[model samples]
Target: MKVNVKYFGAIAESAGKSEEVLDLEKGSSVKDLKNQQIKKYQIQDADSIQIAVNQDLKNEVELKDGDEVAFLPPFAGG
Candidate 1:
């Protein structure tokens, strides 16, 4: 399955892009995808990241083809 990923804030800077397409194996969960991304991007502290699927926040959602995943770093706004 292939999914679209969007990066925000520090996540985007670390990834060096705002969006990307990820090719994942069948039955891959959101957590699995996140792990793969962390490995691919050499992201540190993957557990502290925030994620959304198709614009909705998710914790343990399963991914499907054409799903949009967003990775966001911790926000610090005053």
Candidate 2:
């Protein structure tokens, strides 16, 4: 299965890309992808990262082909 993976802020910088299409195993969970990416890109602050599936925030969810997943860094405010 193929899915679109998006990176934001520090995550994008770490990955050296804003987005990419990945060929993942069928039935892979969101957490599985997150773990793969974290190790692949050596992304820091893993504990602060958040995952979103099809625009909805999620910690873990079964991924589907063509689904869009975004890795969001922790937010900051004044």
lDDT (tens digit, per residue) of candidate 1 on 1-78: 899999987778888899989888888998888888888788877878988898888457678899999997877889
- For model 2, state the Cα shift of residue 4 in Å: 0.4
Per-model TM-score versus the true fold:
0.85, 0.93
Off by over 4 Å in 2: none
- List per-prediction Cα lDDT, in the order shown: 0.85, 0.94
User: Which pairs clash in the backbone of model 2?
Assistant: none
Q: Which residue window of length 10 is worst by lDDT in model 2?
A: 52-61
Residue 78 accuracy (lDDT) in model 1 = 100
TM-score, candidate number 1: 0.85
- Cα shift from native, residue 11, model 2 (Å): 0.5
Give the poorly placed runs of model 1, Cα more than 4 Å off: none
